[model samples]
Target: MGQVHVVGPNRALLISGSGASGKQPRVIVGGRAFVPWIFQRADFLSLELRTIIIESKKSATAYGVMVSVTGVCQVKISGFRESNSGSGSPKLEKDVHAILLAGQHFIGAKKEEIEHSVASTMEGHQRSILGTLTVEELYKDRSAFSARVRELANEDLRLMGMELVSYTIATISDEEGYLDALGISQTESVKKVAQIGESVNRNEGRQRNAEEELKAQLKINEAKKKIEQSNRDVEVMQAKLKEEVNVANARADAAKLFEEAKLKQSIVEEETKQDVVRATVQVDVESEKVRRRRMELDASVRAQAEAELFKKLKEAEGIREFASAEAHRIKLIGEAEAEALRKKELVEVDMLRLKADAYKEYGQAALATRMIETMPEVARAIAAPLAKTEKIVFLGASGGSSSGPSALLSEVTKGAHIVNEGLQAITGVSLGEILKGDSSLNGLERLAMPIALNAVVANQGH
Candidate 1:
C-alpha cells in the first residue's frame, strides 16, 4: 500500500527517487497522489507570495552623489508543470521549465532560505538602478525607478524558479543636503508666482468695475435727456390745444352776433310791411268818405236848385195872369224879372256841372291841395302849447338862446316832412311837389287849382 500525499491550494507536491518520471521529478498541484514509502519521497514547495525588503547604503549615482535606498519586492513560484508526454506549446513549455527549476531549487527548502535568495538578487538590482539615476530622479519619479528595477530583476528571478510580482522604492535619501535646498528653492518660487497672480487678478477686477460704472452713468444721462424732450413735447401739445379751443370759442361768438343781427333786420322789415298795409287801408277809408261827402253836396245843391226853379215858375205864371188883366207895361216888367231868374238858374247849373267834373278828374289831387292850404293852420295848432308857456326853460346841451327855437323848428319841419311822406304813401300825391311847384306833378295839381277856386267862390255865395 502506498501513502496518499494531499496537496494544498498554495503548495505543489514533488515526488523524487524511483517513482519519479525519467530524470525529472513528478510535480503535482492540488488533489492527492500515491507514493510508495520505501521507493519514493514527496516534498511540498509553497506557492504563496513572499515579501522582501531590500536596503542599500552609500550607493553612488551617475553624478557621483552618494545616496541610500530602501525598497520592497514580492515574489512567487509559478505553478505550471509539464505533462507526461511532454507535448505542449512553446509558451507552455517555457512555463513548464520555469516550474521545474523552481521545484528543483526550492523543494524542501525553508521559507527563510527562499526569501534570502530572492532578497539578495533584488538588492543587487536595486543598487545597480540607483547608480544610473540622480537623487532628484529617484525622488521625483519613484514609480519609474521601481519599474526599471522590477524589469531588470524579473529574468534573473525567473531563472531561479521565481517571479517578481511587484517592486517599489519605499524610501530614498541623500547623505548631502542638496534635496532639502532644492525643496526650499521650489517653495519660494511657487509663493512668488501666487503673489503675482493674486495682484494681477485684483487689478483686473477693479478695471472691470470702473468700465461698468461708466456705461451705467452714460445710459442714465441718455434716459434723462429723453425724459426732458418728452416733457417739452407735452407742453407744446397743450399750448396748441388751448389755442384751438380759443379759436372755436371766437368763431361761435361771431356766429351768434351775426344771427342776432339778421333777426333784428327781419323784425324791422315786418314792422315796415305792417305800416305800409295800415296806411293803404286808411287811405281807402278816407277816399270813400270824401266820395260820399261829395255825393251828398251834389244832391243838396240839386234839390235847392229844383225847389227855387219850381217857386220861380209859379211866381212867373201868377204875374202873367195878373198882367193880362192890367196894362201891357206891367206884363213887360214881370217877363224881364222872370227871364233874369232863369239866366241865374242856368249859370248855377253850369257851375255845378263844372265842379262835379273837376272833382271827378282830380279827386286825389284836390284833396292834397286842400290839405296843403291848411298845413300852416295845422302847424300853428301844434305850436300853440309852446306859445302858452310863460317861461321857456331849455334842458340839455344847447348852442345859445336861439338853439331852443331852432331845435323846435327843426323837429316841426321833420314832422311836416313825415306827414308829406305819409300823404304821398296814402293818397298817391306829394304835397311837397305841389308846394314847390315841381314839374314832377302829374298835371292833376294844375287842373285842381281852378276847381279849388270855384269851390271857394261857390261856398262864399252859399
Candidate 2:
C-alpha cells in the first residue's frame, strides 16, 4: 500500500509495533500523525519487519489499586540492506543503517516508557526517567572504547526511564574471535596502532633504560658514601655516648654513696643525740643523788657541829666554874692562913706568959712558996685572956664560926699535939725545932695543955 506524498500539517509516523506492542500507539515523527496502511498491506509489513513479542505486563499498585500489566515487545532489524550486491554504493547502506539505528532507538525508548509508566503508576508519584539502548553487539570486544559505551549507557538510562544501577560489559563471543575468545577481541584499528606504538616505544625504552642505569649507578655510589659516612658518625656518636654514659654512671654512684653517707651521718647524729640525752639524764640523776647525799651530810655535819658547840660551851663553862672555885678556895685558904697566923701569934703571947708563970711557980715553989701566992698574976692574966671567941668573916662582915677557944681546946686534947709539945718541953727543945712540923696549929690545941697541967699538979699536991 504505497501512499502518495503530500505537504501536510497532520504529519504522522505509521510505525507498526512488535511483540506486545502491536497495539502500541504510533508516536509523531517530525510533528505529523500519518495513518498507517499496514492492515491493508499486512503481508508486506510482516515480511519486511523483525518483530519480538512480550505478552505479560508488569505488576503495579496505585492508591490501594493493584494493576497487573504485561511486558513490552522489543523489535530490531537483525538484517536490513537495500544493497548487498557488489555494485551497490555506500549511500543505500547508509540509509539502511540510519533506519535500523532509528528503529532500535525507538524500541529502547518505548521499553523504558512502559517500564517507567508501570514504576510511576505503581509508586503513585512522578519521577525522572530515561531510556537507553542495550545493544549486546556493541560489547563484543573489550577495549578502551568500552569506557565510552559505559558512559552512554549511564547517560541515557535515566532519559529512557531505565535503571542502570549496575552495569557490566558481558562480551558475547559468537562473532569471529568474539565467539572464540568470549567476545574479548582486539579491535583491528587499535591493534595495528598498538603494534606500531610498541615498536616505537621499544627504542625509546632502551634509551631511557641506558639513562636510568647511569642515574642508578650514580645514586648507588652516593648511597654507599652516605652509608660509610653514617657508620663513621655512628661510631663517633657511640664513643661520645659511651663517655657520657660512664660519666652518668659515675655520677649516679657518687650520688648514691653521698646519700648513703648522709643517711649514716644522720643516724649517727641521732644516736649521738640519744647518747647525750641519756648522759644528761644520768648526770642529772647522779647529781641529784649527790646533792641529796651532800645535803644529808651537811645536815649531819651541822647537827654534829651544833651538838659539839653546845657540849664545848658547857665544858668551857664548867672549866670556868671549876677554875673560879679553885681560885676562891685558894683565896679562902690564904685568908684563913693569914688570920690563923695572926691568931697564932696573939695566942702565942698568952702561951708564953702562961709558960712563964708555970716556970716561975716551978722555980720558986721547989724552994719555999705560999700556996695562995703560988698562983702568979701572969697565970690569972693568961688564963683570963681570949674570953672573946674567934670568928670567920666574909668581906668586912662576920661570917660563920664554931665554938671558940674552949671547944677548940677540947678538940685539941684529942689531938697528938699535946704530947708532942710536952715532949718538946721536957726534952728541952722547941717543937718546931724538934720535928720540923708545920708550926700552924689550932689555937685551942695550943692553949689547952697548960690549964690541964696546972689542975693536975694542984691535985697531986693536996
Candidate 3:
C-alpha cells in the first residue's frame, strides 16, 4: 500500500514529478488524491486567509511630508477545484490556471515565509501610494488610501499566484506631530462649528419665543377690542330701548289727552245747547218787558218835556226884563268911568311931559342922585353872600400882610373891582368915572344908573 494524503477545506494538495499530469502539477482541494510512492510527490498549500502586517517607515507623501504607516492585510493563494458541472468555461479555466500558478509559487513554503514575502510586497506598494497622496488623505481617509494601496499591490500579488482579500490601515502616524496637529485642527473645527450651531439654535429659539409672545399680545388686544365693541353695541341697544319706551309712553299720553279732549268737547256742546234754550226764553221775556217799559217812558217823557218848555218860557221872560235894566245900569257906569279915565289920562300926560323936560335939563344931577341912592344897596348886595357864609378860612401865612382881616378886605376889594369892570364893560363907563362925576357922562350914564340899580335891588331881594 502507498501512503495516504488528505486535503482539508482550508488547504490544497499539489502533486508533482512523474505521473503527475505531465509537466503540469495536479491540484486537489476538499478531497484526497493518491500519489504513487516512488514516481510522484505531494505538497500542501494553505488556502485560508493569512494576516500580513505591513509597516512603512519614513515614507514621503506627495507634498514631501514624511509619514509612517502600519497596516494589516488578508491574503491567500488562489483556490480552485474541478467544476461539478463538468464545463470547461473560460471563467472555470481561468480559475484553474490561477490555482496552478499558486501551487507553483507557494507549494511547500512555510506560513512565516509566505507572510514575510507578502508583507514586503504590500509595504512597497504602500510606500508608493503614500508618495502619490497627501498626508491628510492618508490620515483622514485611510480606507481609501488602503484600497488604493491594495489595488496597486494586488496586480503583483496575482502574478505571484496570490490574491489580496482585504487591506486595512491599523495606524497612521508621523514623527513631526503632523497627525496630532491635524487631529487637533479637526477637533477645534468641529468644536467651533458646534458652538456656532448652538448659538444659532439659541437665537432662533429666542426669536420664536418673541414671536409667540407678540402673537399672544395681539390676540389679547383683539379680544379687548371685541369686548369694547360688544359693550358699545349693548349700550346702543339699551339706549334704543329707552327711547322706544319713552316714545310709547308719549303716544299713550297723547291718546289719553285726545280722549279727554273729545269727552270735554261733548260736555261743553251739551251745556251750550241747554244755555241756548234758556237764553232764548229769557230774551223773549226781556223783550216784552222792555216794550212795556218803553211805552211808559215815552208818556212820562212827553209830560216832563211840556213842563220844562213852560218853565223855560217863564224864565226867559224874567231874564229879558232883568237884562234890559242891567244894560241901562251898565251903560251909565261905563259913561261915568270913561269920563274919569279920560281926565286921569290927560293929567298923567301932562305930568310925564314935565318929568321928561326936567330930566333932559338935569341929566347929570339925576344920574348922580340915582347912583347915590343905589350905592348903599349895591354894597349890601355885594356883601350878602359873605353874610351867609358859616365860617371864613384864611390859608395865607399868619404874620404876612395878606393874613387876618387884611386878606379879607383885599378879597372884598378885588370883588368890587370885578364889579366895576363888569359895569364898564356893559355901559362903557367905569364906576370911578361915574363917581367922580366926569363931564364925559352923557346919556349912557342915565341908562346905566337904572340898570345898575335894578340889578342891585334884585340882588338885595334875593
Candidate 4:
C-alpha cells in the first residue's frame, strides 16, 4: 500500500538487489530495467504468491511448438524479470525445435556449448513425451536428455497444485515434423474455469464456517471479560467491608477502656471517702476525752472550795472564844478593886471614933500623948478605902470614944499602919497644928511627936 519509485527496467533480474526492508524498493542496475516495488517486512516471505501468469491460447498458436523431429525439446520460463512493459519479445518454441532436430550432430558441440544451449533454451516441465526415454540415449542425445529432465520437472510442478503449474506441453518432438501447443486462458478455459470456480465455492464455504467460529469465540471472550470484572468488584467490596469491621472493633475497644477508667476512678473516690470518715471518727474520740476531763476538773474545784470554807469557819470560832475569855478576866479585876475599897471604908470609920475619944480624954487630962499620934494613922487608912476624897481633919477633943484605954491600946496595936505614902507626908503638919489649937496647958501636948514616928519609919525604910 505504500508506493515506491522504480529506477529502471529488468533491474531485479540483475541479482544486485539489497536485502528486504520495511520501505518498498524499485530496483535498477546497469542501465537495464526496473524491478517491482514491494514493502519490505519480516514476514513478507509468508504472503501467498497468488498471482500466477497463464498465457492465452493465441500466444501458443502464434509462437509454435517447443520441440523438433529428433525428439529435442525446450521449455522457456523466466525466474525473475523487470516490472516494466516492453515490445518485440522473443519467439520461443521455434528456437527449441531447430536445435533438438539436429540432435546427434549437436552432441559433437563442446560441453560449454551444450550447457549454454540448454541454459538458453526454455521452461523445463513436461509429462507425456519425456517419460519414455533410455538412460544411455538420454546421456548421448541432447534432445532425449532434455526431454527426461522435463518429465521429472513435471512432478515438481504437479505437487504445488493446479494454480502453480500454469503451463504444460505433453509431447513436443521433431518426430511429427511439427508440434501441437495449446494455451487455455482463464476466461475461455472451460476446464480450468470450472476448477477455479469449484475452488472459489469451496473456499467461500470454508470462510462462512470460519466466520461462525470467530463469532462464537468473540462471545466466549466477552463473557470471560464480564466474569473477570465481577470478581474484581467483589474483591473491592470485601476489602471495604473488612475495613468497616476493623473500625467497629476499634471503637468497641475504646469504649471498654473508657469503662475501665471510670471504674478505677470510682474505686479511688470510694477509698478517699472512707479515709475522710475514719478521720472524723478519730476527731470524735478526742472530743469525748476532752469533755470527760473538763467534767472531772469542775468536780475537783468544787471539793477544794468546800475544804477552804470549813477551815475559815473553824478559825473564826476559835477567835470568838479567845475574845470572850479576855472580857471575863477584865470584869473580875474591876469587881475585886470595888471590894477592897468597901473594906477600907469600914476601917476608916473605926479609926475616927478612936481618935475622938482620945482627943476628949486628952481634953479632960486622961489620955497619954501616944494615942493622938496613933489616931492620925488610923484616919489615913480610912481615907485610902475612899481614895477620891481629899480630907483635912479638925476634930474637937469630944469627937472620940467616951471611955477608952488608949495608952495600952497604942502598944498593943503598934503593927497597924496606913498603906498610902502621900498621907504620911502630911502627918507632921497635922500634929503641929493640933497642938497649937489645943493650948490648955494641963498636960504636955508635944509638938515633936510626928518627929519620933518619922524616926522609926525612916529607920525601917533603910
Q: Which candidate achieves the best TM-score against the true structure?
A: 3
Error of 4 at 228 (Å): 5.4
Candidate 3 per-residue C-alpha lDDT over 360-460 given as tens digits, one digit per residue, 9 for 90 to 100: 77665445444433544555576676656556565667555676433544555566567667766775656555444234433333233333323333333
* Candidate 1 lowest-lDDT run of ten: 449-458
Report every candidate's CA lDDT.
Answer: 0.66, 0.40, 0.67, 0.38
Model 2 agreement with the true structure over 1-462: per-residue lDDT tens digits: 434333222222334544223554333323322333554211111112222222212212222222222222222222222556676663223222333334434443454554444333322211111111122323332333234433544434334323233222222222223223422344565677799899889978998999999899999999999999999999999999999999999999999998986776556545444543454355345434433433443344336653553443344344334434644654575475455436555433443454466556555321222211222232233333333324322232245533433243354354334544554466553332322222443323332333323322232234
Question: lDDT of candidate 2 vs native?
Answer: 0.40
Measured against the true structure, the TM-scores of the candidates, in listed sequence, are 0.44, 0.20, 0.48, 0.22
Off by over 4 Å in 1: 80-95, 201-462
TM-score of 1: 0.44
TM-score, predicted candidate 3 vs. hidden true structure: 0.48
Question: Can you give the lDDT of residue 439 in candidate 3?
Answer: 49
- Candidate 4 lDDT score at position 184: 24
User: How much is the lDDT of residue 115 in candidate 3?
Assistant: 88
In model 3, how large is the Cα lDDT of residue 273? 42
For candidate 1, the clash count comes to 0
Candidate 4 global Cα RMSD = 47.0
Residue range 196-245, candidate 4, lDDT tens digits: 89999999989989999998999999999999999999999999999999
Model 1 lDDT tens row, 1-462: 679999976787878889588978787777789999889988888888888899898888879888888998888897753445545443332255666788878876789998999988998999899889987788778999998998899899989988888888887776687767767777787888888888888888888898889889989988998899999899999999999999999999999997886675455445444543454455455445433443443344336653553443344334323323432433454465345436555433444454466567778666764573454345445445555555654354555443432344345555566666776898787765654433443223322322222322222334
Cα RMSD, model 2: 40.7
Number of clashes recorded per candidate: 0, 23, 0, 17
